[model samples]
Target chain A: MASVRNLLVFRQLFHKETSTYTYLLACKQTMKAVLIDPVLDCVERDLKLLRELGVQLVYGINTHVHADHITGTGKLKQALPDCKSVLGSKSGGRADIFVDQSERLKFGNLMLECRSTPGHTNGCTTFVLHDRAMAFTGDALLVRGCGRTDFQQGSPSTLYESVHSQILSLPKHYKLYPAHDYKGFSVTTVEEELAHNTRLTKSKEEFIKIMDNLNLPYPKRIDESLPANLICGVTDPVSS
Target chain B: MASVRNLLVFRQLFHKETSTYTYLLACKQTMKAVLIDPVLDCVERDLKLLRELGVQLVYGINTHVHADHITGTGKLKQALPDCKSVLGSKSGGRADIFVDQSERLKFGNLMLECRSTPGHTNGCTTFVLHDRAMAFTGDALLVRGCGRTDFQQGSPSTLYESVHSQILSLPKHYKLYPAHDYKGFSVTTVEEELAHNTRLTKSKEEFIKIMDNLNLPYPKRIDESLPANLICGVTDPVSS
Candidate 1:
C-alpha cells in the first residue's frame, strides 16, 4: 500500500453563527499540499498545522461563491505569495488559475480532478482525488439533505443533473467531504449519499418537486455574503 | 358564560426568507385594537383586517429590535398618524409612548400590561393583555424553547430572572402570542410555558449551563436587521 499521509480538516464557525469547513490535503513524502473552502481567520491555524505537518502550501481552491462565510483564499495567497489561488473559470473572481471541468491539479504525488457540479450555485465544483479514493463535494451533496437552490442562480434540475451525471458517476467508494456539517461526522461516500441524501435520492422531477416544497425563505445573509463571495471573499479596497 | 370574542393570531412571513409574526388584539363590541410586533409591509393587510372587523387601531407595540425583519410601527403611525407607537423604554428606539413594567395601556375595553423581560436584549419586553387573559411574549419565550441569549447583548442570567420574575409569575391561564413562529400553531398558556419550555424549566444554574452549552452562532441577518430595527424599522425617511 502507498504510504499514509496526514490530512487535516479545519472547521471554522463564521458570521452570526454559520459554520464553515476548510480542508488541507497533503502528501507526507513530498510535503506538497492544497486547501479547499478555507475561512479567513482560520488561515493562521492552517498555516500552523502546515508547519507542524512539514507541508508546503501549493494551491488554494474555492468550490463556489459561498453565501454563508468569507473565503480565506485571498488571505492565504497574501501570506503564501508563492501559492496559487485556483477556482472554476465561471467563479467570476480574481484567481491565479481559472480551472475548467475535468482539469487535473497535481500536488507532488496527489492528484485532484475538478468536476463542475453547478447546482447550489452557477459555478459550484467538486474536486475528486482519484488516487486517494476521496472527493471534496463541497455544498453539492450534503449528508442528509442538499444545498438550497433558491438563490444565487441555483437551479434544482441542474443540481440534480450535476449530482447524477458528475458526482454519482464517480467510484462508489470515494469518500465525500462537504463544506459545512454541524455534527463532527466529517466524511461519507458516493454510495451513501446516493442512498441516504433525501434531496439526491429522488428522481430529477421528484427532486424539483421536493425542492419546491422545501422552498426555504431566502438566506438571511445573502446580500452580505454574495457581494464578498463574488470577489472570492475579498472586500474591495475603499479609497481614503 | 361571559360573551367571548375569538382571540385572533397573525403570523407574517417577512424579509427574503425570515418569518415574523404580528398580532392584532381587538374587543369585538368596543371595536378597539392593539397591534403587536407588526412587520411594515403587512400593516396594510392588518389595516384592512381591522376595517373588516370594525376595530380601531389605537396602539402599536414591538417585542424587540428584531434582527431578521423591520418593524411596522412607524408605517402604522403614518397610516394612522394619530395612533400611538407604544414600546418599552429600553428598546433604544423612539416611540410616541414609552411603557414600563406593569404599566397598563388601555384601549377602550382592552388593557395591555407591560412586563419587562430582558434576556434576548437589555430592552426586550412582553405585553400582557390582562383582561383577555393573553400575553404577547415575543422572543423571550417560545413553545418548547426560549429566545436565544447569544445575540444583541443577550444574557442568560438576565433571561432567567425575566422568566422567573416577570413571565412565570402571571396567572396560569394567560395565553402567549410570540412574535415569530412557522408551525401555524399559535397561543400557548403561561402554565404550558412554565412547564414545557426547556430553557425556562431548568434551575437558574442549570438554565445558565444549558444556555452556555447552547453557545449558538449569531442570527444570519443580524448585521442587516439591527440598523433598521434600531430606527424602529424605518429604513428611510417616512413618506407621507
Candidate 2:
C-alpha cells in the first residue's frame, strides 16, 4: 500500500469541444488511478493518457448527471474491467455504486471525501481529496462564475448555501476544480472564489435574479444526453 | 410552387463541435424544406434557422445511421408536428419513412433522387438534386479525401464501384457535398474529386491498402450514438 502523501499523480485534462475538465488521480506506488467527470466524446483521449502514464484505471467517478454531455464513466467501466462506476445517490441512482455524502471513496490507499453539492443538479457532489488539498466542484462552482441554476432541478438559494458552507468554509488555499468552463480560465481557490466569483459575490437575492434572467438556450445534447445517461450509456436490448 | 431551378433555397449549416455539414433545402415559393443529416446537438440552432428563414420543416433526412453523433430527426419530429423522418431502408427500420435507390423525394415542387452509395455503411445513400447540379455523398465521397472504408460494413471495391457508377458517372460540373468534413474545404466538384481525392484517385488495391493502414480510432461516442441513432434518437421509456 502506498502512503497517501508520498506520491500522487494528478492530471487535469480538457475536452475542447465541450469545454469539459476531466481529472485523473493516481497513487504512484500502486499504479491504481481514478477519473472524475469523464466526457463520452473524450474516452479514447483519456484512455491514451492513462496508457502513457502507465497507470491502471480502477474507478470512474461522476460529479453529477451532466446535461451538456454524456458521462464517460459507463464506457470506462466497460473498457477497464476492474474499474467501478460511481456517482452520488442523488444523481438518479445509476452507476455501479451509488454513494452518499459522508462516504469516502478509496483507491490505492487514497480517499476522496464526497460532499453534497446539489445546486446545478439534484445529485451534484464535490469530492475532496485527502486533507482537502483539492476539490472537484462539478457544475456547482466554476472559477469566476458558478454553474447556471436555471434548470435540471436547480435552485439559486440551494446553490448559494451549498457553496458558502460546504465549499467556501474550507481553508482558503484548497484548490477548486470545476467540471466545465467555456472561457480559458483554469482552476481557482476558495479564497479567489470568495473574493472574485461573479455569481457568488452577489447577494442571495441578486443571485436568484441572475439565474432567472440568464435566458440561455437549453444545452445542445440535452435531449440525447439525458436519455442515454439515465441508462448509463449502454444499449437497451428491448429498445432496439 | 417554385420552379426547381429558379427558386431553390439551400443553406449549408455547420456544427463546429462535430464538423458536420447539415443541408437545408427548400422551395422558396412554398417555404417548404427538408434537412439532411441533422445533428441532435444542433436541434435548437436548426429550428431557429428555420424560423428565421420563415420555412416550414417538412422532413428530416439521414444519409445513413451515424456513429459519430446522434441525429436530430427524432427531436425535430417532436418539435415540428408536420415533419417526417426519412432514412434508407437498409440503415435499420427505425425512421418514419424509408426509400430505396430510384425513389425521388418531393417537397413542395422540388425533388431529390436517391442513389445507393453503400461502402461506408450498408444503407448509405447519396442524394442528387436538379439534374445532378449537386449531390450529398454522405461518407461515400469527401472533398480532397474519401471516407475511410475500414469499418461499418465497408469495402474498398464496393466504394470504388459505387462512386464510379453513381457519383462519377454524373456531370463533371456537379457539386459534391459530403455529410461531414474536418478540414475547412467545402463543396468540391466531381471533376475536382476525380483529380484530387487522395483515396478515390487510387486503384482498387491501393485504396484498400490506404484504408487498412489509416489506423483511425473508433469514434468516441459510438456506443451511445449507435444505439440511440438506431432508434432515430427517440427516447426509450423502458431504457430510461
How would you class the docking of model 2? incorrect
* Candidate 2 off by > 4 Å: A1-240, B1-3, B237-240
Native A-B contacts reproduced, model 2: 0.00
Model 1: lDDT of residue A216? 72
i-RMSD per candidate, Å:
19.0, 14.8
True contacts kept of each: 0.00, 0.00
How much is the lDDT of residue B172 in candidate 1?
79
- Residue B158 in model 1: lDDT: 95
Please provide, for model 2 over B179-216, each residue's C-alpha lDDT reduced to its tens digit, 9 standing for 90 to 100.
87664334667876777677888888988888888889
Q: What is the lDDT of residue A162 in candidate 2?
A: 91
State the lDDT at A33 in candidate 2: 95
- Give candidate 1 regions above 4 Å deviation: A1-16, A235-240, B1-240
Q: Write the per-residue lDDT of candidate 2 for residues A1-240, one digit (tens) a residue.
A: 634544776666666677788989887778889999888888886786677567899888888888888888777777887888888888775778887877989877678999998888888899998443789999899977888888888998999999988898889868888897664344677877887787898999999899889999888988988876765665444763
Question: Could you give the TM-score of chain B for each candidate, in order?
Answer: 0.87, 0.95
